[model samples]
Target: MKIQGKTALVTGASRGIGRAIALELAQQGIRRLLLVARNRQRLAEVAAEIERQGVLVVTLVLDLTQIVGVNIAIARAWRSYGPIDLLVNCAGVAHQAPFLESKLQNLQEEIATNLMGMYTMTRLIGRRMAARREGTIVNVSSLMGKVAAPTMASYSATKFGIVGFTQALRGELAPQNIRVMALLPSLTDTDMARGLQLFRWVLPMTPQQVAKVLVAKLEKNSSEILVGWQSHLAIWCQRFFPSLLEKVLRIVAPLSLSRSKSFGEIANRQQATGNRKGFWRIVLDFGFFRSNIQTFDKGFDQGLKDKFPD
Candidate 1:
């Protein structure tokens, strides 16, 4: 878990937390850094910064969803830069909209980038780590993964999926001496988060702050990491005071999205979209009252966790 002399591969490294983590790893004396993202220019800029810090940096411009391309690039990188000692699955995307009005394309994109994207990278790198019998994997999931948010149903679902994936891997890969973990950072001030209306009572942390916490937690060998006092407090409420937290979420949720529409109009709109199923079932799938019911005793919760939205 030590950063010094480690070879780390960070996805979504073009901007946001991934970018910050790459820089932080360099500052921490990481021997080799592999930065992955779709933006060639941005990835190159990040690699340049790390190179200035005297870290051997490599950048890969490939989409995570493209499995074959990712496999090829990662294989080449491992051959050229040596094995990756740390794998950070920080690549993700978010689409915010009311479930009823949400586009199918948006949800598909979210799944492709957030969930399956993590799956693809983790699977490929995980095999290598297991064979080597030593490595650390940090999956950057979000606070939204712990609590469902209004108008963010699709995004929340993907984040929740990430938590589940990380947990399963944690147990399955433990025998190989590979440490799989999750880092839950609450509302971070980033390009993707800036577009959404801020939730009440939420103090957004900067990407650098989250990155710093990641490194600190890595040293402790924490299977799961939460950033800042805000994340700790939020998860505390979620575990001991479920009802209170749910009520707070309802009050802060951005339900004012379609304020111009009446109830009858909304019902009619749903009917038009061929939503003739039972109301409660649709509500369940839509994430209404969809809370993660679990005991998060001292950051050991497995119920939920998002990737870097850079």
Candidate 2:
């Protein structure tokens, strides 16, 4: 709908697709933005960029799983910054690994941040919007939500949950005149994606591309907006050739080992990383890492072995 002069709140605004979307919203003439993330420095960096575009910005360093804090923060932001007309739930964490190798902690983190966090934000803002009877909400899912991938089982489950929520919420909020939509971006070239093993043929889209598509699609009545040509083709294949698509997915799935030896062994092999970067800091600090890191290391080591055969 109409974005100009409206205020929006975007979670995960510290980086990746969320940051890009926040910037694009500013560019689209949204009057104000309330940016939320766990990292204050990154949020400030994003706020600076958005301010350059002349958008009023308010940044909140938050961990959405904290229910009471979220309640207080959201109420305060609404009172201080004014009511948010649009809410974009984009905060998420991904940990890729074989189902058997997955950890409960990582899965909990995924569900907590991706699904519960979105739910909390939506519920808080949604009630206000429903009262006012005019607002828009966008849930950022992933292509993996539509087509599950092998190494990314838990992450896929959380995304599927988001897609499900978007669908159900759309029906639930329709009578109140509040709009709910899903944005599915395929294999985005984000910090989270880079930590995983690359699939054979699929290409990753930049966060900016995803943001541009979201902004453009908001003008339409479409319930789901998917980014990139690859996503469209994959979804089309999934719709028509389910069996063949499964086979193709298997062929392109990343390498996985049958067993994990030990956590220490995996940590040592992380030598490939001289100094872990910002992404790793976020994940590790949040306890968001899984056997996926080990899986990636082993796969990388095995690929080297296969290529040079010592």
C-alpha lDDT score of every prediction, in listed order: 0.80, 0.85
After superposition, candidate 2 runs with Cα above 4 Å error: 257-310
Q: Give candidate 1's whole-model lDDT.
A: 0.80
In angstroms, the error of model 2 at 85 is 0.5
Q: Model 1 over residues 1-310: C-alpha lDDT tens digits?
A: 7889889999999998999988888888899999999999999999998899899888899999999999999899888888899999999887778788989999999999999889999999999999999999999999888878787899989888888999999999999999999988988867777667545445567799999889878888687788888778878878866666666676556656544222233344556886655344334433444542222221233222211123
In Å, residue 305's CA in model 1 sits off its true spot by 30
TM-score of each: 0.82, 0.83
Candidate 2 has an lDDT of 0.85
**lDDT of model 1, residue 23:** 89
Worst window of 10 by summed lDDT in candidate 1: 301-310
Number of clashing residue pairs in every model? 4, 0
Models, CA RMSD each? 12.2, 9.5
Candidate 2 local Cα displacement, residue 129, angstroms: 0.2
